[model samples]
Target: MQPYKKLFTYWFAVIIYDLTVDFTKSYIKSFKLKEQMDGAARSGKQNIVEGSEGMQTSLKSAIKLTGVAKASFEELIGDLEDYLRQNNLKQFPKNNPKIEIFRQKAAVLIKKLSDFYKNESLVRNLSNLSYLEKYFNTSSVEEKVNLLLTLCHQETFLLNKQVLSLEEKHKTEGGLTEKLYKARVQHRGY
Candidate 1:
């Protein structure tokens, strides 16, 4: 099984975490909300990593963990939405030009990071957070919240797709335990 670390979603989670940290530090004054937001962001990212690492041994576990990651991102979406509502900020609509542009840039950056990791030996170690950090730092609070919400939505969508695929594969092929049992039987000439 390919490591989850290789997935673009994993790096997206990292970027999400970085942006959340910056958002909370610069904009959120309530310590409790800040901690809760940060925790959710971290959980979203970490669960994906855990899910990927367990994929080889247990598809069921991976599916569950990935679901957890999706839930965490959903929680973040709520937080970002709440922040915008409470502050009387307008969220970017689905058809907004800025939303489309940001989505495109995010996709490009994720692909770049994926390629970098795929060829880590040839490329110098680099962080993709810089690209977003620049925008995050300069954007208004409303824009920041909107961008984060979009990211959360994207992450949850990806996670859901991943879970469905894993479930399908599990149904058709079974897990490591089944494979091991089959190998054992064959080895014993059953």
Candidate 2:
């Protein structure tokens, strides 16, 4: 389990959760609607963790769970995009100046969180000016969700690659049942 892989996804979920929980409180005046958002975030993180933990015993199940995680993130990202559209908020361009700043902040926060877990390589640092906590209250809900959508894109990229790897491994190596059968044959000297 690469820290930057599933671990990054988990942190991104936590980051979005933190942002949305605050934003929705004021924006919507209630937490009821956030249950759907929370579901997606929790599913994305939990599925990845479960899949990683089960990989040793069931690679196929792990792959399926990872796909589920990817889908959950996609669902959340889609909902955010729709919200922006319905509310007439523009999605920021990839090269927007604020995006660069947000990316820098994300890099720092991810690195710090990774370091707290003793996984420094989980992120790369490019700035030291400030963390998102300082800017959260000042930034718009649209901005926060837009930034999170960018991260969702990265997570999907990693997930697609991971699924491809899993598929290839399953094709070449088969599954646990086949391995168990082979082990049994070897033990019987057949």
Report model 2's TM-score to 2 decimal places.
Answer: 0.78
What's the residue-level lDDT of 103 in candidate 1?
76
Best by lDDT: 1
Top candidate (TM-score): 1
Which pairs clash inside model 1?
Answer: none
TM-score of every model versus the real structure: 0.89, 0.78
Supply candidate 1's per-residue lDDT for 71: 93
Candidate 2: count the clashes.
Answer: 0
The residue-level lDDT of candidate 1 at 113 comes to 69
List candidate 2 stretches off by more than 4 Å: 1-6, 29-32, 115-131, 135-138
Error of model 1, residue 44, in angstroms: 0.8
On the 0 to 100 scale, the lDDT of residue 108 in model 2 is 65
- What's each prediction's clash count? 0, 0
| C-alpha root-mean-square deviation, each candidate | 2.8, 4.7
